[model samples]
Target: MQSKTSSYLANLLQFCIDNKIHKARKILHAYLLRTNQFSNTFLVNRLIELYSKCGHPTSAHLLFDQLSARNIYTYHAVLDAYCKSNDIDNAYEVFAQMPERNSVTWNLIITALSHNGFEKKALENFYLMMMGGFVPTRFTLASVLSACGGVSDVGCGKECHGVAIKLGLEGNFFVGNALLGMYAKCGFVWEAIEIFKGLPEHNEVTFTAMMKGLMETDRIHEAFDMFKLMHRVGISIDSVSLSSVLGVCAKSSFEDFVVVNDNDRNWYNVHGKQIHGLVIKLGFERDLQLNNSLLDMYAKHGDMECAEMLFDNMSEVSVVSWNVMIGGFGQKYSKERALEYMEKMKNHGFEPNEVTYVNLLAACVKSEDVETGRQMFDDMSCPSLSSWNALLSGYSQNEHHKEAVMLFREMQFRNVQPDRTTFAIVLSSCAQMGLLDGGKQVHAALLKDVAYTDLYVASGLIGLYSKCSKIEMAKHVFDELPQYDVACWNSMIAGLSLNSLEAEAFIYFKQMLGKGMLPTEFSFATNAGTTNVSLGCQDQHCEYVKILFYNRYLAK
Candidate 1:
């Protein structure tokens, strides 16, 4: 009869474990107590694990404390319960009191620490686990390597890699993938590549790790090649690999390629289309992240037709999806379509996020609709710097120079603390409006904060003075700059040419050539305009100018 009762209780616990019925589990626990069977340590541990899995960590903890015959299993149950509860302090306290721990115990702590964003502590516990003479399992190695990657602790990562090699576990798929991810995320591209090659086999995750690492290092073309090889080898492609491929596609959206419909089908888009077909064939059409990446890639590549179709068909639409779609319309200068999408987004019960409004402001700027842009800017509940900058950019784009300066003052009044972009836009606005005093004030602000001393700001200052007919002031600003980046030189030449200082502009142009600074399209265009001034100069200077153009072959 006693054996039958124990078996019955075991069956009952199994049912609760399978069905996740915490109430039924509690009732069984009460029956065990009434039958004087509460001394069963194994049964209590199972109950605790069940309760924890059912999201009743408190009940699990209570059952753990009531166990009369506690063992390592019982303690592990409670530790997991505490960790799952995010009560890490209590979990560590229980760990400190445990008289014995197995590999699972150490792995649990490390994983729990890493999951809770205590990666540094996870590493320390890993060291302590090793000192305790516990052999690290595959899970432990993965967690430790992940922690190392999180903090970019390449030294620790290398040591972990060495340990994996010595243990002959470096070839293990999970371990190999972890090491690959670690090296990739830490900017150790070569090591990551080596591990990737050493993997006896490849999986979706392995490809993702390698490709992500390559993209991170800016070896974009090589990354695409790997992606192509993966697809051609008939290796299974999942959402992750597809997203990585899409990221590469987005980056490869240059202007030279052929246009397919509304989208420019660059070299990457061919692969992108193949990956898209593969995604559909694999029945992953419902994957939100992958589809979102596709939408963004298409939008960036000038393929709004594909983006719109994908957006309309996605079963799950996030704010990101809507934003990307709107941004696509904005990119194509379709302000009406963008606004219509904005309304539809609202009708679908999604509120406009910061990105949505930023794109709309951009569309307004593109259409030269400053009034609409201002209205949208005013409607923003929380105006981030991007929002402010968007409107400021709109003002500058539409030749609303006075309004741009006025909005800059409004930004200052509201304590919206201008950033580098703000100064660049507003200074240009002041220059265009011919507001000398306003330009001087903006310059003073740049002087007050060294944060605005970047190349764009230097370019803006030079442009401002030249447009204001203060050639000497522009020269002073140019001479005072400690660095001469491409933009700075371009701005100097452009300013000199536009201000009818042809001789000075030509001297700078020659000096730029001597410095090996290749002229941009703007450089040639501005200098070409100065040819009218050069027309009145000596024949020798005019002939030399033609030689410069012919030799540089600057632009069409």
Candidate 2:
């Protein structure tokens, strides 16, 4: 017992699906002539959704206008249409006109807000839905959790976790995964790990979350163990797992951990080459991030030739890859090759970021290409603070003390305030040039600008005063410092030795040891010719010599 209106609607739907738009419109017009009941609300809503899906929102709006009475579903349909077309404002308008709203209505609005980067607003809507007595489903919680994670709103994320637990939705696979992702991304690595360990069952998503969390916290060993556990449990690894492990391999300093036998200088190289094979077997060679990670791993292990080979074979090089190759060349002191890669990066339509410029500046500084460095600095369209510091450091390192001072003043004139590194470099320059007046001026400006005194800055200031032959001023800065590390004491000792005050240097060295501070090479070297053999060999002094020897050997 199919009604004539239903039959006509079915035929229209079939015509719409078959790309017969004109035929469908003619059929609908004939139906309207034959039956007064053809303009039913359900029929109209169907036509609107069909037209909107067919990429004709204007026609959908026209069909929606012909409806005599709009139900909640009709409004929802139109709102969805507006959202699909990326006309969020019109969707909001349709939502506002709804006389009554349901959970579906609220979910749509929340998702729209999240997509538009209105994370705060999306969370607010979630709260409103709760106040309206609508119990959120798993989809609702997932969307809200994602929004909270986007803004790193740890407080709201915890609240959502509590709500999910109370609603007995914690075991829902999607909800659990989202919660883990939120905790991991928000720096709650310990909490994320606890959640993973306590999970009733583990999935691939669970393992990925735990691995990502551990990696984010710099617990590379723990992350690798988790990956191994995943393999033992027979869980399939995906792109994310491979990417995370590659990142760990890239950042881990293998030389520091791998103890090579006396006969084998190539031990670390062998291990790194094995890892490179694993990367190929996993078929991640085409992944830009993973490829760059492999390149970095090989470069760090002193296999620059293999690193270069990998770089040449990359099908698509990103800005990160370019930076890695450039930095590798810079580390090897190959200025010409580094500059050529930098030009290639630009020619490939990849704009250089702060890191790229920093490496280039370091290369220029090492090559003593002060003129070229200055040109690069001047050509920057929007120089970051790090960029300014690099240029100033280059000038200082090249013994252009006056030029460094000039650049500092020019930075101030341009309203670019100097950071801690800038002060450190400039103070070191003042020390080299014996510019007491400039040092004092910088000290005053530092106190005025820096809210908290850094130990490094204080040490630099002390070294500057001592080199300028102002030992009293050096003592004043040192005495005012609230905390003193070994470096601080080393600076003072070196300063005393430079002034030919060997006795004072030895005395300070004894005081540093009394404060439980260890002596460094500079400290030992400063007291090398002191007239205090008996003092040096006092109680447990043999142990001190052993420690010094060990540290010196390791340093070499």
Candidate 3:
């Protein structure tokens, strides 16, 4: 009778596992517990697996704790539960307590760490696993490779690639794809292409990874070619790849498309529309992500008509879809239309998230509606740093320099840390208002943060000191920069010209050319304006300066 009953319950548990009948599994769990069969290790492991697979991590964990005679299978099941549920801290805790681990054990924890953004920790554990004399499986190498890519540690990733080759698993489809991804993410597009060529079979994932890598390296022409190749070679086109390709199209300017088609400024619209037509032809029109991409592409290209039409047709719209519409209209300076859409979004039961408010704030910036922007910002449950930066930037851009400085002080009083954008914007405001003391305080705060190395912030400081007749302070900041981009060089030159030191400004401009830094229109304009400052000198010397300026900058 006991044997028959055991067979019946085992079959029932298998049914629950196969069908994912959570309630039935729970009933079976109770029965096992009541009849003392819960002590049976095999039956308990299966129950734990069923619970884990069904997304009931708490129950699975409870069963794991209740088990008196746990084995490797028991630990694996519970570890999987935590990993799948993204409970990384608990997952690592379980791993730490495991009596003995196999390759599978290390793979689970490593993959979880990689997926959860602990890339460094994942790589650290991979070496520890190697030192433990546990050989990495194909899955283990793939996970470790992903961690390597996340951290952009191409050196370690190449070593892992060598390990894969030594194990004769380099050509294995899963490991090969991982290698492609790692190389591509590390900015080694050529290396990724070599792996892609060597792979015996190419799937949608493999093609998408290659396309994204190519795009990352600004090889958009090659990426689009890959997209065309995917369709020609009969590789299945998925939403992710299509969305990525559409994003590239949306962001591309006429200059970007000029190489593909000469002098065609409308190529962005044409390419976006072609992709939209392809999406419809391929029956992906109903795909929410693809539809959102279509909307974004149209919106970015300033085709609000098509964007709205596609947005209306989306059967299932996510918050991202709503945000895209708002951002699209906001950027086009259609403030009223953006606000209408925000109202409509709320009516559709979507609460305005941080991104939603950020878009609205941007719209306010474009329309110069500072009051409305402030109201919208205050409405946020907890305004993010980005929200603060948006309003602060709006103030600075609109010439409300005093208001910007005041808002920045409020940001500091609230204990909200400012990022690079915050420092740059506030410093600009101080420079504009000639508030040297306030700029110094902001600069002091910036020095305590990593944003001191930022070129824009450095330039803003240069402008602040130069405007206050403190050219020495401005030059000190310029000299202290580890490297000088064109902006910093221009700032230094402008500071000398602003302080009536035209000869020094000329020397700095020549040095800028010597350093191979390209002079922009702003650099030319700054130097040209200095010609006026030298008018009181000797006529010959003034003519010499004018002739030099006209020849060097105005002629161009």
Q: lDDT of all the models against the reference?
A: 0.85, 0.78, 0.88
lDDT per residue, candidate 1, 381-450, as tens digits?
8888998998999888888889899999998788888888999999889988889999998898788888
Clashing pairs in 1: 263-302, 263-303
- TM per candidate: 0.67, 0.63, 0.84
Candidate 1 vs candidate 3: which has greater TM-score? 3
For residues 91-141, could you state the per-residue lDDT of candidate 2 as single tens digits?
A: 788888889999999988888877778789889989999999998888889
TM-score (C-alpha) between model 3 and the true structure: 0.84
Candidate 3: where is the Cα deviation over 4 Å? 1-35, 120-124, 127-133, 151-172, 186-201, 217-219, 257-268, 500-556
Q: Model 2, residue 247: displacement in angstroms?
A: 0.9
User: Of the candidates shown, which would achieve the greatest TM-score relative to the real structure?
Assistant: 3
Query: What is the C-alpha local distance difference test score of candidate 2?
Result: 0.78
- What candidate 1 gets wrong by more than 4 Å, as runs, is 1-27, 36-43, 61-141, 144-172, 186-188, 216-219, 254-269, 384-386, 395-556
Please list all clashing residue pairs in model 3, or write none if there are none.
Answer: none
Better of 2 and 3 by lDDT: 3
lDDT of 3 by residue, 290-345 (tens): 99888888888777888898888789999999999999999998889999999999
Residue 389 displacement in candidate 2 (angstroms) = 5.2
Q: Rank the candidates by lDDT, best first.
A: 3, 1, 2
RMSD to true structure for each model, in Å: 6.8, 7.6, 4.6
